[model samples]
Target: MEHNLSKHISGKFNQDLENVRNHVLAMGGLVEQQLNSALDAVSANDSEQARQVEKDDYKVNAMEVSIDEECTRIIAKRQPAASDLRLVVAIAKTIADLERIGDEARRIAQVALDSFSKEQQDLLVMIDNMGRQVSKMLHDVLDAFARMDVEAAFKVHKEDAKVDREYEALIRQIMTYMMEDPRSIPKIMALVWSVRSLERIGDRCQNIAEYVIYFVKGKDIRHISQEDIEKDILKL
Candidate 1:
């Protein structure tokens, strides 16, 4: 009877761990869907689709809260240490970034459907490309977490620099146009907001990549050197 009870408790604990993992993956799926919806809304200039993103923001917020609460409960009850602890802590931290990324994507969708004229629409091409790249980076980082693939995470981290450069050049080009013609103020401001939203997405990608190190090797990889990130990636 004692052996049977111990086996039952162990099985239940493993089941709870699996539940926690699924909750995180479900949250990831929701965010990925949000990004895709925002992209479609932007590309089509659909105000209804933009409204959908705005509506969906609440879901992401709620999921973040749920995951956070669940993690807290698991840590207190299970007393996980080492790698298990790292995974829980990393999820708790990364959920915030994921929520913020969802917000940024929704903001872009809103701004894309804003009252910009035809000419302003043409200039949104670069902004669109940046959005695609950032979304893919987010997806890739999540994949790394799923598989514990450190190399994939680092690749996402390095790719963010290109996004940053693109954003800088984009800002410069817009300012030049605005300077060349003062009458383009409102359109330029709208474009600026759009570009800023895309840039923010890239920033979140960088944060998520840093969390990957903690998820695997139990290290606070933030503010650490590139060489260290590379070394961790080499392990997977």
Candidate 2:
């Protein structure tokens, strides 16, 4: 009789874990959609689309709270140990990152609402490219998390460096333009802010990939150097 009860409890715990995992994935899907909408709005300079993206942020925020609550409940009730506990913790962290990415998307949407001069249109093109790159990174990292693929996560981490270089190049170009014509400063500044937000989104995606590594290997590689991270991942 005791053995049967233990088995039943174990099954219930597994179900709860699966439920939370699904919730996180759902939240990730919503976040990805929000990002793409915001980027598209900016590229097309569509205020209505940008407004919709801004309004939808509330849904993402709500999902973050819901997922966190569910994770907390599972931890409190199940008292999961070892790998199970790691999974819960990683899910919670990933949700937090996703919520921040949502915030960044909203900021990008706000940029779309701003008035841009014809001269600034070319700059928006560069920002659009950055947005698309980060959006792809986010999509890839989420897939890695879903599959628990450490190798894929590592590849995503490397992609972040490319995004960083692109961001830097964009900033340099904008600065050059500002120096050439101070009158374009305001528009250029807005583009700079938008690019920065996209860069942050990339950072968040990288962080999520790191969490995937932690989930699979049970290692905390948050602050380690890239050299060390590469070595550690290779060892796996």
**Top candidate, metric TM-score:** 2
lDDT of 1 by residue, 125-234 (tens): 66777778878888888887666566677788888888889899889988987888789987578778767877887888787777776665556777777776566534
Instruction: Give per-residue lDDT, candidate 1, residue 79.
Output: 83
Model 1 residue 130 lDDT score = 75
Which whole-number lDDT from 0 to 100 does residue 120 have in model 2? 78
Candidate 1 — which pairs collide? Answer: none
The local distance difference test score of model 2 is 0.87
Q: Which residue segments of model 1 deviate by more than 4 Å?
A: 1-12, 231-236
Candidate 2 residue pairs in backbone clash:
none
Top lDDT prediction, candidate number: 2
lDDT against the true structure, each candidate: 0.76, 0.87
Q: Using Cα atoms with residue i matched to residue i, what is each candidate's TM-score against the true structure?
A: 0.88, 0.93
lDDT, candidate 1, at 161: 87
Q: What's the CA error at residue 125 for candidate 1, in Å? A: 1.2
Q: Give the per-residue lDDT of model 2 (tens digit) for 1-236.
A: 00111222356588888788889999999999999999999988899999999999999999999999999999889898877787888899999999999999999988889878787788889889889999999999998888777888888988999999999999999999899999888767878888999999999999998888887777888888778977865463
